[model samples]
Target: MQIILCESAEQVGRRAADIIEARVRQGPAVLGLATGGSPASTYAELIRRHREEGLRFGDVTAFTLDEYAGLPADHPQSYHSTIRREFVDHVDLDLAKLHTPRGDAEDLVAEAARYDLAIVGAGGIDVQLLGIGANGHIGFNEPTSSLRSRTRVKTLAVATRTANARFFEGDDEEVPKLCLTQGLGTIGESRQAVLVALGSAKAAAVQAMVEGPVSAFCPGSVLQLHPRATIVLDPGAASQLTMLEYYRDAQALNDGLQ
Candidate 1:
């Protein structure tokens, strides 16, 4: 795992966008995308690149990692709608290449399987973008979920529901009880992975993910097992990490004269 401590959230977002743009230029890049407040800045950065840098996504295909089951696709709080507003509408990506697990599908399992097949058929993801939930969940794969599991429906943890409540008229009860998410095994299949975290609220989770044992208690910790995973954090989020200063120096040296 590689740790990158950026000066601020915007820098982290720009760096993540740069890596994604680089991958998309190589070929038909398949991207594993995530939603939530943690990734909002990164999405903004990508939009900026698309508008100002001519970063095209015509050959790029994307699969969102998860979506709230039972939620209307057009719902403002739905992941599908968020993606459309933040990404799909901003870029020139082929609409046919975008895949979001159907929230209202009659057979969710089949939809999940279709998403997995699409990823496999595309030669796996070129880059997987992730956001670590406050409870350490990744892609709605809550704590205690099997690392080897595949895309499927999962019950939302109480913590997740509460965390998501802000988006749903401030009513925790309005948050969906279940979601469909790609599993850790699927995430590990990516050629590269980028996990972004910001703010002091994420400090504990960031520390657990970067330094703790790879246990199901903290799903984000599984990223440590990936061959190429980058964790980008703001200083507030890296506060609890003991080796953050070392990582900061290393990144400065690696990006020398930039």
Candidate 2:
């Protein structure tokens, strides 16, 4: 695990984007994408690069981390629609290569299984992007979510609903109660994982995810098991990390080595 503390949210995005650009350039890349407030800036940076620096995605295969259950694919708040509107639509990629769990499928259980199979068939994710929830959840894998669980349906926590209420015009009741999320085990399969967080609001979750004991209580803590997990954060987000100075020094040392 590498902790990269940046000066601001935008800097955090740029840093993560640097990794994404490097990975994409390595060869055909399978990307694990996530949504929510945490990754919004990273997506913005990617879009900026696409428009200004000719960053292309023709060889990329993208898979989203989760989708709200009961939401139509075209629904404005749907992950699929959000992905397209905020990231995919701005990039030059083959639409058919992008995949998302079918939130409104007739047989969602089967679809979830199929989604897992599809990811494996595609050789797993080269690099997965993640965002820690305010309550320490990753994707929609709420507290106590099985560490070895696979792709499946999950009930959203009340905190999650409240956090997501802004998307529904500040109505937590309007937020979907169910979701399909790539489980911790599924996320661990990725060759590399990059998690980004910003602002003081995320400090506690960031601390738990980076330094807390590996436990189901803080689902994001599962990232500690990943062979290659990068925790990118702004100073505000890294504030709660006990070894902030050490993390900064180490980052500087690593930067100097390059």
Question: Quick one: best lDDT, which candidate?
Answer: 2
Model 1's TM-score against the true structure: 0.96
Model 1: per-residue lDDT, tens digit, 175-244?
Answer: 9998889988888889999999999999999999999999899999999899999998988998999986
Least well predicted 10-residue stretch by lDDT in candidate 1: 249-258
Give each model's clash number. Answer: 0, 0
Q: Which segments of model 1 are wrong by more than 4 Å?
A: none
Candidate 2 on 1-258: residue-level lDDT in tens? 999989988998999999999999887999999998888889999989999998889999999999999998999999999999989999997889999999999988998899999999999999999999888999899999999999999999999999999999999999999999999999999999999998899899889888899999999999999999999998888889999889989999999998
User: How far out, in Å, is residue 161 in model 1?
Assistant: 0.6
What is candidate 2's TM-score against the reference? 0.98
Residue 195 displacement (Å), model 2: 0.2
Q: For every model shown, what is its TM-score relative to the native structure?
A: 0.96, 0.98
